[model samples]
Target: MRLRAMVHRHHVLGPGRVPALGFLALLATVLLAGCTSQGGAENSLARPLMQGSTAPRAMSPVERLANDLAMADVAFENGDAKALANHLQSVDLAGATPSDANGEAKLNAWRSSIAAAPPAMRGRVLGPAYLSGILAAGSRINTEQVLLGGKAVSIAAGTAPRDTLRLRIVRGDGKIVCEKSPAHARECRFVPTYTQRFRIELYNTGPEDARYHLVFD
Candidate 1:
């Protein structure tokens, strides 16, 4: 799949916040391992350009998260593993605070889709373990872990467009809130009312690496 259009936004100082405004369009093609990206291409796409500010402002927490998260989205969709890792190196894991032992969780999904392919391809799929959760700062897919993170994170597995991208979103410690399995049916997942840690596992249930563009907010 090819990302026909990607609008990269500027890190603007909004009314007490930073808002990420953009859109995505997908064009299916023979999956490319990754595409050649231009330097500073993302900066040029920033919309609602800004002018003058008296002081250089440090990014707000949400703004910072959005920034790193945005970069991660691009790198992942582009099928650039190293780029994905570098873009998210700044995100601290403090947000994943553990919930109470008795806390209750909620789950919601419009539909569910899991792929069913030949069993022979199983070896190609279950190959990586996102070692240090959230595709950690130094996580290496070639070694052991190659996990991706964000409000929405996906890693497509398979040579063909039949990407069996299995996703599992687990909350702080041992709490499993939402689980979406197989195929290009991207899981919209959940927006938990409570604050907690999230760990995602990408199982490649296809014959080769799957590739697809993701629209992450």
Candidate 2:
């Protein structure tokens, strides 16, 4: 998916600025909680505005890195710094620690990329169909209600050398549609008769930690 200009803007009413900002902060906290919670089934089905092509090419290393940064920018612009930070913190740098120069460089680069965005564009409400987070070693499920009209969906996983990630997609009707156990990345094109809810289940079959990023475009 391409990184385009954000359409939704938050306007503050006079004398209600404090409350508005407070509400937004509260909402962010709640959303993050919901992301981490083993919440009940989600039922809303809203189509994603970003649609992927029929045949998407595999992203080059540089392109993939750029896309990850772009997704972080999207989360940041949408006022979801927690999500962006989570993505950065969960980045698997092949055992590089904070003291490691190479690891620090990559970390700093992620921070700088988000910081370099225009101030006015930071902290807006996030849109639908983009999810990113870290998954511990085990079976984990990340569910989202998305509008799917056969758009191409991309799943990217980052983990240690020995780690493995499996992705399973379940439709609204409780039917499994696609399943893939990939070393790092996977892409599939799916078409739904109409907009509906879908569940994305990720299994960390390996012995180490796993991080993933998903987008429908």
Candidate 3:
């Protein structure tokens, strides 16, 4: 949603009418759970809801990362420090390489930002509908899924920035549903008229192995 939070019936609530800050202190649970190994890596305050987009769907880890970042973008534009703090907890700063090439200093800056935010906005949540695998050079992987009728379907995929990955979605009869040329990131969206299976094809045209992650909602 919009990363907007409102006090509802005496509680701070975010998308899907879920409690955003049950109490500012509860956010610590999210930080410890998502950033650490508490209750496993997937524990959180809530998984960002895509309920209307699919029947009881959960965002995959990759999808949740994308959604949280997307929400963080909105928070940044609107100067919603609380939302920014909440959404960013999902980022694995401990293991991430900074695109800025500033190394640990850059990551520490991010940690400082998160640490400085008020206790209320320091948590992250994501759904689960993702696929990931390694593709050898010049190899392809085919996957299929059943998308029910009357729901908006969205899919996002990406590979290492240096890889050339082409993605295509096709129907049983060979009709192309969506296609993306060689690139680092791709997305597809549609609303099917009826329940049906669609095939997803990922081709690695690069000269080395490529790992890909695809998420849907």
Compare the candidates by TM-score and give the number of the best one.
Answer: 3
What is the clash count of model 3? 7
Q: How much lDDT does each candidate structure score?
A: 0.34, 0.52, 0.59
Candidate 3: which pairs clash? 58-127, 58-128, 59-127, 59-128, 60-127, 60-128, 60-129
RMSD of 1: 31.1
Q: Best-fitting candidate, measured by lDDT?
A: 3
Which segments of candidate 2 are over 4 A away from where they belong? 1-109, 113-129, 150-163
User: Candidate 3 on 1-217: residue-level lDDT in tens?
Assistant: 3333334523533353544556555888777777677554344423434333566556544445544544544455466767777765654421212232333343354446554743322243334344545679999988888888889787666565334788788976789988876634446777888899999888888888765555565
Rank the models by TM-score, top first.
Answer: 3, 2, 1
lDDT of 2 by residue, 1-217 (tens): 1233222222324446888899999999999888766343232222232343256677743224324544454554566766676555433321112323543454555576554422222343432133445567766756665756656554433333323777678888989877767634454446776778878777788666655544443
Give the TM-scores of the predictions, in the order they appear.
0.26, 0.42, 0.45
Q: Kindly list the per-residue Cα lDDT of model 1 for residues 114-186, writing each as its tens digit.
A: 1221122222322211111122222212221223343333322211233354545555565765554542333
Q: Which residue ranges in model 3 land beyond 4 Å of their true spot?
A: 1-88, 91-126
TM-score of 2: 0.42
